[model samples]
Target: MRASLIQIAVDPDESVDSRRRRAAALVREQSGADLVVLPELWPTGAFAYDLFAAEAEPLVGGPTYEVMAEAAADAGVWLHAGSIVERGAGFDGPLYNTSLVFSPAGELTRTYRKIHRFGFDKGEAVMMAAGAELVTVPLPEATLGLATCYDLRFPELFRGLVDAGADVLVIPAGWPERRRAHWTLLARARAVENQSYVLAVGTAGTHADVRQAGHSIAVDPWGEVLAEAGSGEQVLTVDLDLTGLGVTREQFPALKDRVLGLAEPRR
Candidate 1:
């Protein structure tokens, strides 16, 4: 499939509507892409977590989502709208760092909340709810597992996604430039261990207090870097072989040789 990853610049100063417009234009320009993925919190800056509750929109009510859905429907391509500050019931809006997927037909197929929030040093991440489920949404072209930023740190989540028949892992992140090496290493590791394609998309530019290193990449199951982009506002495109993931798994059979099943507790 011809996939395009948008390494967008987080304009913390720009209104969400303005950024949405720019994103739509970028997608429209990538006419040949079958699927388009965006960076985490593209509408707003990740470090601007303080604005999340106020800037958040209901999953179904946001103009940001509507615009992307319309764009996907118009272009007849699938879209991973990356991460958005969404509002849920009771709390006014988006309760989690949620991502939404839209089909070519403009139908909302699946929604995945970030399973692991990146709260290692900063405690702001801990302010949000930890998503409990690993999304393995079935697309017409392939079955995709959805994850975001810090979730990349947890190999078990990707393993579970792969075990659940995921052919590709879609990860959107707002990774810092300080730990850029970790971003690349973790992404490649997931692809190697899971034996599936890993699409890691991150943002560039400063987000109020933090700045992200944009090195969006597409890694094959063999951990080969198919296509990579530097720290810039660019659309990194790559053609991925969905069948290769299946073929590799069949040829190696390593995934079947696992023995990490649950064990009885010692008495």
Candidate 2:
């Protein structure tokens, strides 16, 4: 399956509407790709916590959703339109860092609200409500396990997706440049351990005084990096060999040997 990871550069000068239109155009450009993925919070820079409330849109029929749905239909591809700051319910209701997935027909297939909110006590942690459910989207080629930026650090979340029969992990992040190494390391680790394809897309350039880590990477089941972007806006496209995933798992069979429900370490 062919996939395109759009590493968008969230410029501070760009208006949210401009970025939304540009993102939709980019998605439309990937006409032949089976799947196209974008970075997290592309509308407003992820670290731009103050703008969250101003830019937050409804879960459905929002500007981002409307444009991206049309883009998916125009390109005839499955599009993971990254994430948006979702305003839940009525006035003063909770906000959510939500990821959206659209089918080729422009239908809203699945939505994954970011489970692991970023900031500990401030920023997103306090501003947004945590999502309780784990979401997986079933595609014609592969089943995708949805995760956001901070969620990548938690192995248990990925494991849960695997348990639910996810072979392709699609993580959209707005990771900072300071922790680029961890981003790459953790992405590879997730793919290697899960024996699945990892499509980790992140933002580029600077926003909210934080430079984004633009090394949007794709890792195969064997832990090999297939494609990676630089510290700028780029589209890293790769052809994923889904059939080889089963071969890698069959050869190593590490997943089958997992010992669950072990007793706590002798303390």
Candidate 3:
């Protein structure tokens, strides 16, 4: 299946509605691609905590979701509308970092509220609610494990996705420029350990004073870079071999050897 990971450079001045319009257009341009992904929180900056209240849209009943649904139908392909600031009734106020995926039919497949909220001593913790569940959205081509930026650091989550039958792991991030090396290393490490395709998409330029490194990548089951992008706006397309993945896993059998129980006392 053809996949297009769109590395968008969102303008700080652009309105949420305007940005959504442009993102929808980009999705249509990559019409032949089976899955087209966008960067995390393109409308509101990743560190723009203040905008959460202003831009927060409900999971189903909002302009952002509406746009994603429209784009998926228009392109006749699966659309992963990177993420939006999700505001809802279940929560006290709103959830800052959340992602949503739509099928070709525009059906809502998965909703992932970012489990690992990035504090880094700054203050994201004060802004959003963390998700409690791991999500894997199934498609005709492959089952996609959903995760936002910081969640990539947690190995258990990726393991859960693999156990949940995720063939392709999708991460939409607002990774900062300062820790870019960590981003690349972590992505490659996840692919190598999991033995599955990792499609990690991020944004270029600065957001809320934090500069992002836009080196989107698609690592194959063997941890080889199938496709990669620079620090700019680009769409990376790559083909994956799902069948070969099964063969590799069977040969290694590391997953079967994984210890799931509690640890023993130190000697």
Candidate 4:
């Protein structure tokens, strides 16, 4: 399956409306790709926490959702439209960092609200509601496990997805440029441990106080990097074999050795 990861530049000067149109156009450009993925919160910069409230919209009728759905239909590809700042029922209620998936027919296939908020006490942790459930979406060639930025720090979540029959892990992140090494390391680790393909797509340029890490990457099941983009706005495309996931797992058989017994108390 061929996948295209769009590493968008979230400049502070760019308007939300302009970014939405640009993103949709980029998705449309990947007409031959089986899947197209975007970075996290491209419409409103992820670290632009103050704007979340004002920009939040309902998941069903949100502008990002509407534009991306049409883009997926036009491209005839499965599109992971990164994430959006979702406003729930009440305007005064907590918002969510929600990721959306659209099928080739422009139908909303699945949605995953980011489980781990980035900020510890302030920012998203305090403002947004955390998602409880893990989500996985089935494609024509592979089952995708959904995750967002901070969620990469949690290994148990990826393991759970693997156990749930996920062959590919799709992570949409808006990680800072300062921690680019960690981003690449964690992505590779997740793929190696889970024996699944990892497609980690991140943002580029600077947004307010944060400078995004734009090294969008695709790693195969064997922990080999297939494609990686520079710290700029570009589409990184790669052809991944979904069958290789099972082949690697069968050949290595390491995941099958997992033990879940309770740890013995010390001294």
Candidate 5:
């Protein structure tokens, strides 16, 4: 299966509307790809916490959703349209860092609200409500486990997806440039541990004084890096051997040895 990961630059100078339009155009450009993925919070810079409320949109019929749905149909590809700051129902309702998936028919297939908020007590942690459910989307070629940004650091989340029969893990992030190494390391680790394909896409450039780590990457089931982007806006495209996932798992058979439901560790 062919996949295109668009590492978008989320600079402060670009207006949210302009970025949304640009993102849709980029998605439309990947006409022949089987799947196209974008970075997290590309519409209104992830770290731009102050702009979250101002740029927040509804889950359905929002500008980002409308534009990306059309782009998916135009490109005829299953598109992971990154994430948006979602304003839930009612004025006082919570906001969610939500990721959207659309099919080739321009239909909203699934939405994964980010489970792990970035900030500890401030920023996203306080601003957005955590998503309780784990989401997986089934495609003709592979089943995708959805995750976003900080969720990558938690191995248990990926393991849960694997338990639910996800073969490919798709992670959209807005990781800072300072911790770029961790981003790459963790992505490969998740793939290796789960014995599944991992596509981790992140933003580029700077916003809210934090520079984004743009090394969007694709890792195979055996922890091989197939493709990676640079520290700038780029579209990293790779052809994934969907069958290789099962082949590697069968050859290695490590995941089958996992010991689940262990007792709590002693203090």
Candidate 6:
């Protein structure tokens, strides 16, 4: 399957409306790709926590959904439109950081509200309600495990995804430049450990005084980096063989030896 990762340059100065149009144009350019992925919270910068409430929209009828659905249909590709500030229905609490996936025919296929919010006590943790479910998108070519920026740091989540029969792990991040090494390292680790392809799409440029680490990467099941983008706005496209996951896992068989019940949750 061919995938295009769009590393967008998010600027605090640019309006959300302008960025939405720009992102749609970019998605429309990838006509032949099987999948098109965008970075986390590209409409508004992830670090721009103050704007989350003001910009939050409903899941189905939001502006982001409208633009991305059309773009996906036009490009004839499965589009992972990345995380959004979701203003949910009947939600008296904070909004959710939700990820949306669109089918080739411009239909909303699946949604994953970010389970792990980054900031411990402040920012998203305080501003948004955490999601409880693990989500995976089932496509004809491959089953994709959905994850967001901070979710990459947790390996157990990826493990659970693999248990659910996911062969490709899709992560959309807005990681900071200071911790870029962690971003790259963790991505490869996840790929190697899970024995699945890791498609991590991150953002470029600066927002909220934090420079984004834009090394959007694609790692094979063997932990080899297939493609890595620089710290700029560009599309990183790579053709992947989904069948490699089974081959690698069958040869290694390390995942079968995993020990369960090692750590217990606190009461």
* 33-140 per-residue lDDT for model 5 (tens digits): 999999999998989989999889999999999999999999999999999999999986789999999999999999999998988899999999999999999999
What is the C-alpha lDDT profile of model 1 across 61-111, one tens digit per residue?
A: 588778888888887888998888777776653368889898888788889
TM-score of each: 0.94, 0.99, 0.95, 0.98, 0.98, 0.96
- Residue 146 error for model 2, in Å? 0.4
Question: What tens-digit string does per-residue lDDT give for candidate 6 at 43-77?
Answer: 99998988998899899988999999999999999
Q: On residues 1-267, what C-alpha lDDT tens digit does candidate 4 reach at each position?
A: 999999999988889999999999999999999999998888989899879999998989789999999999999999999999998787687799999999999999899999999888988899899999899998879999999999999999999999998989999999999999999999999999999999999999886779888999999877789998999899999999877777888899999999898799898
The lDDT, on a scale of 0 to 1, for candidate 4 is 0.93
Model 6: which ten-residue window has the lowest total lDDT?
87-96
Which stretches of candidate 6 lie above 4 Å from their native place?
91-93, 262-267
**All models: lDDT?**
0.86, 0.95, 0.87, 0.93, 0.94, 0.94
When 1 and 5 are scored with TM-score, the better candidate is 5
TM-score of predicted model 6?
Answer: 0.96
* Clashes by residue pair, model 1: 86-94, 87-93, 87-94, 88-93, 88-94
Candidate 1 wrongly placed segments (more than 4 Å): 91-94, 120-124, 262-267
CA lDDT of 174 in candidate 5? Answer: 95
Residue range 46-135, candidate 2, lDDT tens digits: 999989998999988999999999999999999999999999999887999999999999999999999999888989999999999999
The number of residue pairs in model 5 that clash at the backbone is: 0
- Per-prediction RMSD in angstroms? 1.9, 0.8, 1.6, 0.9, 1.0, 2.1
Candidate of highest lDDT? 2
Candidate 6, RMSD to the unseen true structure: 2.1
Clashes of 6: 0
